[model samples]
Target: MKLKFFGAAREVGRSCILVEGKSTRILLDAGVKVGEEEAEVPTIPNSMLQSIDAVIITHAHLDHCGYLPHLYSNGFNGPVYALKPTLEIANVMVNDYLKLSNPRDVNKDWQKKMQRKEKTVEYHQEFRVKDLALKLVPAGHILGSSMVEVRLGNERILYTGDINLKTTRLLEPAYTEYLKADTLITESTYGGDKDTWPPEKDVLSGLMKSIKTTLDNEGKVIVPSFAVGRAQEVLFILDDYMRSGTIPKVPIFVDGMIGKVNRIYRHNVIFCKDELQKRILMSEDDPFKSSNFVMIEGKADRSKVLKHQGAAIIVTTSGMLKGGPVIKYLERMGSDSLNKLLLVGYQAVGTPGRELQDGAKEITLDGKKIKMGIKVETFHLSAHADRPQLLRLAGRIQGLKNIFIVHGEERKMMELAAALGKHYKVTVPVLDAEYTT
Candidate 1:
C-alpha cells in the first residue's frame, strides 16, 4: 500500500489523497480550495488515474468535497461514493460552487457535465466496485459527514474526512472504534499546541452574553455563521435558551443560504439525533420554525429585514465574514455602538471575520471601510477537535503505525506533529509529499 499527500497538506483547504494497493487505486476527497480565484490540484499520471476504481468523499464541506465536479470533467470515470445526506448536499453544494466560481452563461454547460456522474452510499452498508471495498462510519461533523474505511487486498485503511468527536446539539459523536484498521488517516484541523477549545457550556454562555448585551441595548446582533453545522448549532442553542427564559425572545432573522439549508436539515432530520427527528414529526412541535425567526430571502426581502426596529438577531452566512448577506448586515449594523457582532466559527486569515476577531476597528468589505464601534466577540463552537480532544481521539485508534496530519495551519499541524512525536512514531508528511508502505 502507498499513501500520497496531495491537498490539505501543510494547509487547510482542498482535501485529496491517494491510496494505491490491492490492484486498485482509490482517490479520497478530490476537493478545491475556496480561498483563491485559481487553485492548485495534485495531478496523477493518466495511467494511475484511469485505473482508479472509486472516489470517496467524507463530507459535504466544500473544502472536503468541492472539487468533485471538476473530476467528472477530467475524464476520470468511476463511482463517486458518499453518505446519502453527503450526496444530497454535495449535489446542492457543488452546483453552488460552480455558480459562485464561474457565474456566466458559458459555464452552465460545465456545471451540467459534472452533476451527471455521481453516486450515493448509505451508512454502514459496504459496497464493492471493481477492486475496492468501501464503507462509511459517522464523522459527527455535519448532517451527512462520515469517516471512510476501505479494505483492499488483505489491507485495511481508514480515512477520516473531517471528524468531530464531540456531538453537538444536532448531531451524534464520531464513531471512534475501528477494531481492525492498521493504518488510520485522521484530520488534524485543530491539531496544535494552541488549539485549545473552551468548554461547551462556557462557550454557550459567552455567546448568549454577547447577544444579550446587544438585546439589552436595543441593538441588533449580527452572527456570521456557516449555513450548515454552525448555524444549526447556534439556532438549537438559542432555541433552548429562549425556551428556558435565559434570553428574551426577539426578532431573529436568518439570511443567506440558511433558510434553504434549514429545509435540507428538516428533510433529512433522521440523519440527526433521534429526538430531533421526533421533535419535527410530532404534532405541535417545531423547533426551527420559532415565532421569532424571520427567514430572509431575496434582495428585496433582506432590505425589509434590515429596516426592522427594536432589538433583533441576524444570522447570516459566508461564516468567515468574507461575503454573502453578512456583509450587507455588517454594512448597515457595523457603525452602531448598540449593535454586536458575534463570530461562531473559525475565521480564515485575511477574512473580515478574522480581523474582527483580532480587534481590527476598520475592515474593507464590498469596497468600503466597515468601521465599527460595536462590540465583537468570538466563540470556538467549532466542528473540529481541539488539541487535547485530538490527542484523545488519537489514543482511541488501535495500533496506529503512521499518522499523517492534514487540513490545518502549518503551525498547528507542526504542533500536532511535535506532540505526536513524543509518544508515537508517526510521519507528518509535507505538501506534494509521497511515501510507500
Candidate 2:
C-alpha cells in the first residue's frame, strides 16, 4: 500500500489523503482550504483523477468534504462513502458551497448529480470494494464524524480524521478500542506543547464571566461560531447554564446557517452521546429549543437585532469572522466598549478572528475598517485534542509500524512527531510526499 499527502501536510486546512492498494485507489478526503476569499482544494494529478475509485468522507466539515462536488465537476463520478448523518450534513454544506462559489451550477441538475453519488455507511460496519475493506468508527470530533479504517490483504491502516478523545457536551469521546494498525495516519491540529487547554469548567466560567460583564453593562454579546459543531456547543452550554441558574438568561439569537445545521443535529440524535440521546428521548426535554433561543431568519429580523439596544447574545456563523451574518452583527456591535466577542474555536492565521485575537485595534469588515472597542475574550472550546490527548490516543493503537502526522502547521506537526516518535517510528510528511508500507 502507498499513501500520499496532498494537502494539510504542514497546514491546518484542505485536509486530504490518498491511499492506493493493488486493486483500489481511494481518496480519504478531498476538502477545501477555507478562511480565505478563494479556498484551496487538494492537488490531485489529472492522470490520477479518473483512476481514483472512491472518496471516503470522515465528517461534514468544509475542510474535509467541501471539495467532493468539485470532484464531480472534474468527471470523477465514483460513489462517495460516509456516515448517514455526514451524508445529510454534507448535502447542506456542499450545496451551500456550490451556491456561493459556482452559482451557475446551483440548479436541479447539479443537485441530482450530488444525490446519485452518495453511499451511506453505518458505523463500525465493514464494507468492501474490490480488494479493499473499509470501516468507519466513531470519531468524537462532531456528529457523524469517524475514523476510517482500511484493510487490504495482510496490511491494516487507520486514519484518525479530526478526532477528539475527550467528551464534550455534544458528543461522546472518540472510540479507542481497536488497538492494532500497520500504518497510522493522524491529524496534529493541536499537537504543539503550547496548545494545552484548561479544565472545561474553568473555560466555561471565564466565558460566562465575560458574557455577564457585557450584559451587566447593558451591552450585547456577539459570538462568531462555526455553523456546525461550535455553534451547537455554544448554544448547549449557554442553555444549560441558564437553566441551572449559573448565568442570566438572555435572548440568544441563532442566525446564519446554524439553525439549519442544528436541525440536522436534531435529525441525527443517534450519533450524539448516550446522555444527549436519552434527553432527546425524554418528554419535554429538547435541549436545542430553549425559550431564550430565538431563531433569527430573514433580513428584517437581523436588522432588528442590529438595532436593538437591550442586552442579548447573538450566535452566528463564519467562526473566524471571515464572512456570514457575524459580519453584520460585528458591524453593529464592534465599536461598543461594553459589548463582548467571545471566540470559541481555532482561528486561522490570516482570518479576521486571528487578527482580533492577536489584539488588533481595528479590523476590516466588508471593505471598511471598524474600530474594535468591544471586549474580546478567548475560551479554549476546540473540538480537536491537545498535545497530551493526542499522545494518549496514539498510545492506544498497538503495533504501529509508521505514524504519519498531517493536518497541522509545520511546527505543530514536528512537535507531535517528536513526541510520538519516542515510542513509535513517526514521519511528519511534507505536502505531496508519498510513503509505502
Candidate 3:
C-alpha cells in the first residue's frame, strides 16, 4: 500500500490524499485552500487525473471538497462518493466558491456534470472501489462530515477528515467504537500545546456576556460566520440562550447563503444529535423556525436590516471577513464601540478577522482603510478537536501503529507529531511527499 500527500501536507487547506492499493487508486478530498490572495488547489498533475479510480469527499467545507468542479473540468471522470447531505451541502458551497472566485476555466457544464456524478452512501456501509473497500463514520465536525476508513488486502487505514471529538449544540461526538486500523491519517488543525479550549460552559458564558453587553447598550452585534456549520451552530446557541432567558431576545438577521444552508441542515436533521432531531420532530420547539431568527431576502432586506431601530444580532457569512454581507455590516457598524463583532471560529492568517483579533485599529477593505471601533471578541467554538482531544482520539483506536499528521501549520503538526511519537511511529509529511507500508 502507498499514500501520497498532494495537498494539506503540513498546511491547513487543500486536503488531497491518494491511496493506492495494488492496482486500485483512490483520491481522498480534492479541496482548495482559501483565505489567500489566490485559492490553491492540489498539486496533482492533469495527466495523472484520469488514472485515479474514485474520489471520496469527507464533507462539504470548501477546504475539503471545493475542487471537485475543477477536477471535473480538467479530465477526471470517475464517480464522486459522499454522504447524501455532504453532496447537498457541497453543491451550495462549491457553487458559492465558483461565483466568488470566478475561475474562468470551470464552466457551468462541468459543474452540472460533476453534480450528476455524485454517489451518496450511508454511514458504515461497506463499499468497494475495485480492489479496495471503504466506509465512512461520523466526524462530528458538521452535519455530514465523516472519517474515511479504507481496507486494502490485510491493511486498514483511517483518515480523520477534520474531526471533532466533543459534541456541540447541533451534533454528537465522533464515532470511536471498536475501530481498528494499522495506519492513521489525522488532521492537526489544533494540535499544539496552547490549543486547549475552555470548558463548554465557560466558552458559552463568555460569548453570551459579549452579546449581552452589546445588546444592553442598544447596539447591534455582527457575527461573521461560515454559512455551512458555524452559522448554524451560532444560531442554535443564540436560540437556546434566549429561550432560557440567559440573553435578551433580539432579531437575528440571517444574511448571505446561511439561510439556504440552514434549510439543508434542517432537511438533514437525521444526521444531527438525537436531542436536536427530537426537538425538530416531536415538539413545537423547532430551532430552525425560531421566531428570533429572520432571513434576509436580498440587498433591500440587508439595507433595511441595517436600519433596524433597537438591539439585534446580525449573523452573516464569509466567516473570515474575506467577502460577503458581513463586510457591508462592518463598514456601517464597525466604527461604533457599542456594537460588537463576535468571531466564533478560527481566523486564518492574512484575513480581516485575524487582523481584528490581533487588535488592528484600521484595516484596508476594498482599497480603503476603515477604522474599526466595534468591540471584537473570539470564542473558541472551533469544529476541530484540540490537542488533548486529538491525543485521546488517537489513543482510542485499536491496532494503530503508524500515525501521519496533516492539515495543520508546521509548528502545530510538529508538536502533535512529537507527542504521538512516544507511543507510535509518527510522520509529518510535507507537500508532495509519499509513504509506503
Top-lDDT candidate index: 3
Candidate 2: deviation at residue 16, Å?
1.5
Determine which window of 10 residues in candidate 2 has minimal summed lDDT: 102-111
Global fold similarity of model 3 (TM-score): 0.98
lDDT of prediction 2: 0.87
Screening candidate 2 with a backbone cut-off below 3 angstroms (N, C-alpha, C), the clashing residue pairs are none
* Per-residue C-alpha lDDT of model 3 across residues 1-437, encoded as one tens digit per residue: 79999899988889999999999989999999975466888998888889989999999999999999999888999999999999999999998898888786797788899999999999999999999999999999999999999998779999999899999889998998878899999999999979998998999998998899889889999999999899999999999899998899889899999999999999999999999999878998799999989899899999998788889999999899888899899888889998999989988878889999999999877566789988999899999999999999899999999999999988999999999999999999877777985
lDDT for each of the candidates?
0.79, 0.87, 0.91
Q: Candidate 2 on 31-60: residue-level lDDT in tens? A: 888644557778877567788889999999
Clashes of 3: 0
On a 0 to 1 TM-score scale, where does candidate 1 land against the true structure? 0.94
